[model samples]
Target: MSKKKSFPLRLDPELYEILQKWAADDFRSVNSHIEFLLREAAKKAGRLKKSQE
Candidate 1:
């Protein structure tokens, strides 16, 4: 496994609540769900290399 970077992020309360529910529905933590969404987006946009996937 790779060492993960840590940083603080700010989100609107309403958005956070929505993400919280979505995360629960997916059986994931909010943090991991966000990362999964971003990774999928990057892959779709061809911004991520194959190795990165």
Candidate 2:
């Protein structure tokens, strides 16, 4: 397993529900799904590179 960093996040109720549903559909925990979404978003924005981490 990778080293984990804990942080606090805030989300709107509506967006939170949508993410929750998507997580359930994918059979993943909500936190994992959010992490995946963040990774993808970062890839598109070029904030994350192949070896940055």
Candidate 3:
């Protein structure tokens, strides 16, 4: 596995709670869900290359 970058992220309490529930529904941690969402969005926007995806 490649080394993943780590950074601090801040979100509003309401947003965080929503993400927590969504993550649980998908059987994923909140962090992983966020990454998944971002990756899919990048792909849809043509911002992510095939290899990257």
Candidate 4:
């Protein structure tokens, strides 16, 4: 694993609830779900280049 950093995150109430439910359904932590979403979105948006910081 690379060096890890922690940052405060803010989420919309409704959106966060949905993400929480989906994450539970998939048996993944909310953090993992968010990471998956970011990876996929980056791929689709053509921003997967330049090392996935």
Pull out the clashing pairs in model 2: none
TM-scores across all candidates?
Answer: 0.96, 0.79, 0.96, 0.76
Q: What is the C-alpha lDDT of each candidate?
A: 0.98, 0.92, 0.97, 0.89
Instruction: Give a tens-digit lDDT track for model 2, residues 1-53.
Output: 87989999999999999999999999999899999988999988989978853
Q: Lowest lDDT 10-mer window, candidate 2?
A: 44-53
Report the error of model 3 at residue 52, Å. 1.2
Global local distance difference test of model 3: 0.97
Please rank every candidate by lDDT, starting with the best: 1, 3, 2, 4
lDDT per residue (tens digit) for residues 1-53 in model 4 = 88766788999999999999999999999998998888899889998886874
Query: What lDDT is reached at residue 16 by model 4?
Result: 94
Q: What would the TM-score be for candidate 3 when compared with the true structure?
A: 0.96
Clashes of each: 0, 0, 0, 0
Model 4 superposed RMSD (Cα): 2.4
For model 3, how does the per-residue alpha-carbon lDDT over 1-53 read when each residue is reduced to its tens digit? 88999999999999999999999999999999999999999999999988897
Off by over 4 Å in 3: none
Residue 5 of model 2, lDDT score: 100
